[model samples]
Target chain A: MKDWKGKNLIFIGGGIAMPPIRCAIWYALENRADYGNITIVYGARTVGDLVFVDELDQWAQKERTSVIQCVDPGGETPEWKHEIGLIPHVIERSNIPAENSVALVVGPPIMIRFTLPVLDKMGMAKKDIYTSLENRMKCGIGKCGRCNCGPVYVCKEGPIFSFEQLSQLPSDY
Target chain B: MSDVIAKDDLLRLVDQWLAEGKRVLGPVKAGDGVILYAPLAASSQLVLEGFVHAANSIKEAVFPRSETIYTYKFNGHEIELSDVDPDSTQCIVIGARPCDAASLPVLDHLFNWDYKDKFYNARRAATTVVTVACSEYDDNCFCTSVGLGPAAEQGSDAMLLKAPDGWYEVRAVTDKGTALFNGKTTPAPEIKVPISDGPAKKFDTVDIETFLKNNYESDAWRDITMRCLGCGACAYNCPTCHCFDIVDEGDAAGGRRVKNWDSCQFGQFTVHASGHNPRAVQAQRQRQRIQHKFRIYPEKFGAILCTGCGTCTRNCPVSLGVLNTLEAIAAVARGSIEVK
Candidate 1:
């Protein structure tokens, strides 16, 4: 509800999280003028596994949203021109500046680990990259110790966190 | 005068509370030596001398294991959202163990810290916690080591202590508890013997952090967690272990996103939709479970998220108690390589 007005947002990673991320993105893109340009670079193992494919295409048609789907090599796909390489390579080839743009990373843990270094390579400091973790959470509130990744419950302190915050915690996270 | 209540008088007070329409729930003897918390309709329902902690914590009465948070409907292309308000009944939880009551305050910090979680805070605000001190101890019990006493003021608004000759010491520590005896009250009964407070139980958790940090790739994890079935019983039964999953269930016309308790021990917890799981192996999941409680929780919240309540130990299908895990790590820290 706050003025996300004038912030360029990008979501990297694809999964069950994609729908929720898209839900939030749609909310932002609805207020596009309020929220600056929105772009989503979604990565998955294959094109068959991409979530919200049609929805992403429709949003990109309006130019209010742009989506790049990354698939593994030799993965099944119908020819639609988008970023075709792995996530890190796509980021390297694409000229998306990391200085001011907010990037949301949501994917498997290995993807999370691999992407952080790319952000580091691009000189993207921790704060600019936001990621959401899906730890086994029961109580969205912190009372249940189930979602604990140390001091923060992934449910309460965040399903959303910065790379800087994640870096400080123990590696088990 | 305000501290002591005879056994009959104590029962009458509970009856009076229930008579005044307050919901009273206490520990009940469930099947197979399991103690569960349920509504106590009569004085005889109270278990004044139970040993182990309840099968589940009193948190369920407040923060249920599963509850709907919100509902969303897709109408054509637009979406409509609705809020889920928690139940607004005043409930009293009696016969809560010391560890169970103590664990609530630790949970309060994250619930009310940044964003105001109305669901948790609402139930917490409405409910009065009555903690019963432990008369017996187990080797797995470590409440004393973690800044808690057998009879401690961790989270109880009012604490009930059983004294000799069928007398109970009723001490009011919070305003709501004090208000229970505001008007013209009957005189408190005298006790025959002073309450017994036991010595602190000691365990060497002294380098738990260092051990975990240094032994990231140790084979000990695999050996210890080999018997884990990943059933999540340990998480489900714990008093302080609160993790959850939010899922949207329903048709396009209307549906609800309900949150249910989740466990890190399960492979599905961190599995992406692409069918790739981060913690596919149980060792990684087991490591996560331990570090999250000991190292990570303290790192973020300045308090270890465990009360050493031994619920996990008592209920584990494989007998891989978290206490033994900590002890193993501490033993390794002390340079003992003998595998248990």
Candidate 2:
């Protein structure tokens, strides 16, 4: 319930990390009176693999926040009224203003890579986009040298960094 | 800061530091004409008269090759996790080459930006670097091209220069270095040095971004990378090549989380569980390696990631040096194709 007034946050992918992202989203939702719109654009390879479907449905039902679910058109799923396509396609069609939006992109590197250009086309600066990096985090505090991308260790320095920071590294992550 | 420390007093300084119950890590011969940063038990252990850079950078002292991140235990179908200890130790790295020391700050920028990493930061904070100037430059060396020189002091707390009459000129650059000079440290004698202009080898990385963008799919990579063995010796030895992976291991009862080194040359680097890979070919992987260093990193930090240390060129099994790659790409962009 900490004040997030006038802040627009979005999460663009769904994986095992969805529950944690939901917890973060709900934390923002509790203070909707103080925060701006919170949107979760959950994309999965198929409808079945999309975890937390029921919970997201409940949130969308009460209109606590907006949820956009995109699945492969060929993938099986019960009838769902959300968008069906790639997450990047959904993002482009959602008409979200990139200038005022702070996106938290977490997924495989390929998915993260595909979403960046769309955000860039939507006018989001590299600094406005944050993504968590996964590496060999031998020492979470940055000593083991396993999780370092360049100057940053994904574990200690960040599991989170602006795309700008990641762009500086040699893609070791 | 105070006056410099003379070369002759180097051993006396080490003796004093050891007497004070402090440890000193310096370059020592480790066989196969290689040098490693190891503990100095005596003044003879220090190789001050050498012109070669250490085979490996001193990153291992701060970030070890392997360490436990967290421990976990399984109970029936459930699992529990426990935290590992943070690494914090005081030490001194002596006789680091200018190129190696200079890489520290660039590495620091990424590790300390958002979340503070205590592991590497703790060692970086606790460790005091003493860099030595390189008296000789080889064909593979390109420190001058990347804003670092054989004599650069980019990341040192104190710098050591070899002067005539077997004397060394040491300058303290940081508060930590100044503190080292205040207690039990004496000024080093000055030595005469010759004025020199231009390096033995020079490179112009101007407009590298545009050059790389235009040559992304050029045949130069395929032509040059044919001899590559896919071994990551270059990355493992390069001072600035930092990449790793994390994994959890143990039985159903308990296990530990560990982090270990990984390389872009591996087949699984960009592999996904769903059987998709972006850099499945050697050509793409090589491109990823070079672009990340020259194009991407420069665009991010406003500086090139490669320090031109030449470690990669020297250590590669088939000698797929980054210099050749840079030259090839640049040549192609300039409307020519050449590898020499």
Candidate 3:
């Protein structure tokens, strides 16, 4: 209830779901004084799939925030010196403190499925974790019935849902 | 006071509408035991007979299958964009079934929710829907199960009930309906229409809605959707299934943006750009279809997204009906099985 000023911001983004998180990253940097310690753990199938490289570098260079990048095994290049594995494995190994942290993750479905459990083990409650669903939506409004999860239209009700909220919906998507 | 118009007088109304150069769409005989809404030029063409409702609902009267929301033109170097205005032309829609008529208000809640869809709103404003009460029943019709009736005039401007002796009782329900009278009526008090006998309620929706939420992770989804072809014939023909995709057609310089009907039944509906599909299989898609109508839409809109029109089952190749799906959920609600 103390607002986001003191909350540690963790954004786990990779692949195509990176843009929205990158937008959030820029917002956090612009209003950096409004937030606390920021950590971004991002990964991909390969270094080539990594998005927002410039921004990632900028975050890594920031004095307060930490940016950890990773690539799947055998996907590392000669220039790559970071961790080699899935993002959750990297974060678990990096040992970032989970106290007072609210993490927003956006990535492939498999990545989300694996990453959330890792965050849970780090002491993050289901309510503290958030992800958006782009569930095959149409009519961005609720009129179109395509992107629904257990009576919730992902387009109108969410492009965003917390882990606790996701648990309440049907597991169709 | 309400009055009755002769069945012949109704035809004269259609003729007058056609003479006025206004868009008149009504049910016409499509084939044996089938009727579809189409442009009407003659009163003789209206087929307010047989079937629970027309093969298609009155949805397209407001939200079309595809329409240009914005038009963009590129001339050599410069590009100009124009906004498509809501249709202002007078349009009269006659012979919509009670369930189909009820769909307009159901759709109103959604089109107006989150953001107002002006394209749909415009057509809704321009069109006056007149519905016929049902006197027949089909195996697929189930409006009663979802809180609507065979003769419920929830969205109609005019109510046309077929009575004995070839007489049609026309009750003007709204200002638009009243305006159709133009201050003329031959009050025929003897006109009486026996209430329409609607199809039996297949399953209770309240029980189904509750049971569906708790069984999201259940395996019953796979068994129910195993034979699904994902043809999307249901979504397309449904009066309340209003999913649409916005696409930019043409070239990079300038292209017109169009909204086309999209379906949850397709695999591409939830595929990410990284080639990952969350609802990767038919069971998931089928789960999405059921939960949307029974559970999700109700939570947000306070109404079921289905009219129980059964157009989907009627058109589906596999004969996979929504009634069967609802019954399956009802079975779960009765505690016979957990749907797991």
Best by lDDT: 3
TM-score of each: 0.74, 0.68, 0.90
* lDDT score, candidate 1, position A19: 72
Model 1 regions more than 4 Å off:
A1-173, B71-80, B181-200, B204-206, B213-217, B338-340
TM-score of 1: 0.74
Error of 3 at B323 (Å): 1.4
| Models sorted by DockQ, best on top | 3, 1, 2
Model 1 residue A120 distance off true place after TM-score fit, in angstroms:
6.7
Q: What tens digits encode model 1's per-residue C-alpha lDDT throughout A1-173? A: 25334667777875455876776777777766776567788876677778778887787786656777777666657774565767877777777666556778887666777777787778777877888776654455565455555556677678788889988664444
Candidate 3, B4-34: lDDT as tens digits: 7777877887899899988898988866857
Best-performing candidate as measured by TM-score: 3
For A16-104, candidate 3 gives per-residue lDDT tens digits of 66787888888887788777889988888898988878878888888679998899999999999888998778878888888989999
RMSD of each: 6.1, 7.0, 2.9
lDDT of 2: 0.71
Two-chain DockQ for each candidate model: 0.28, 0.12, 0.60
What does candidate 1's lDDT look like per residue over B102-122, in tens digits?
778877765766676778888
The alpha-carbon lDDT assigned to residue B20 of candidate 2 equals: 72
